[model samples]
Target: MAQYTFRTRSSDCPYELAIGLVSGRWKPRLLEVLKDETLRYGDLKERLKPVSDKVLSAALDDMTRNGLISRTAFAEIPPRVEYALTPQGESLLEALGPLRDWARTENGR
Candidate 1:
């Protein structure tokens, strides 16, 4: 399985590249909204309404494959699954805090 990384490009600023890694239309929202909790697929889909099922699935897969999120599958009569941030993901969220704050103030939110 191929994994994603921000270091793939050599010419870009490291910070910019790092920021770009989570710059997908839904990725930053996913990370921010999910920062405080673990969520099942259906719950996530509901919370991220307006996003197509295919796009959400692809974003989750990319984050999971890249080690940013951990997916737990439960075996039951009906299978259940959940997603939560990994240590790396938590750290990334912390790193984005200042940027988020800056944006908020700049936009007068």
Candidate 2:
């Protein structure tokens, strides 16, 4: 994956920054899945079937690094880890509503 740097410049477009944040193949889908509820790693792996373990782990790490998601780990016999969207992530999802509507309308749904 290519590294992206978001610079705070007057000429920098906010749209680009937003797009960069959710630019991965699995990111938007992951956000949608996380929108409804907090899920464990295994649960997410199961829900997003056919997604390889390495790719899923990397995507989760990237999302977490970008502040789009939160990871919580619990100490137990088997260990527990959960993922959920952050406030910024939720806001991003809400912002996607219009885009979603536009796509649906374009598709004549």
Candidate 3:
């Protein structure tokens, strides 16, 4: 696994910081999936079919580090892990509503 750091200079725009956090093929989709429900690793992997384990893991790690998602691991015998959006993530989703709506309208949906 690679190490990802979300770095921002003092002059960096707020939009750039926000975009940097969620800028990825899987990050946005991962956020969408965790928007309403908490799911296990396997469940998330299943929902995001065709996504490689490496990419999925990286995305989850990045989101976790950025404080957009929370990861919980249980101490059970077999081990249990779950993922869900954080409050910050929920706020981001709300902020993205206009963009989503614009896309929907553009697609005539």
Top-lDDT candidate index: 3
- List runs of model 1 lying over 4 Å from the truth: 1-12
Considering TM-score, where higher is better, how would the candidates rank from best to worst?
A: 3, 2, 1
Candidate models: Cα lDDT each:
0.81, 0.84, 0.85
Error of 2 at 22 (Å): 0.7
Tens-digit per-residue lDDT, 38-58, candidate 3:
999999999999899999999
Pick by TM-score: which candidate is best? 3
> What TM-scores do the predictions have?
0.83, 0.85, 0.87
Candidate 1 lDDT tens digits, 65-103: 767788999988699999999887788889989988999
| Least accurate 10 contiguous residues by lDDT in model 3 | 2-11
Clashing pairs in 1: none
Of the candidates numbered 2 and 3, which has the greater TM-score value?
3
Relative to the unseen true structure, what is the Cα RMSD of model 1? Answer: 4.4
In candidate 3 the C-alpha lDDT for residue 33 amounts to: 94
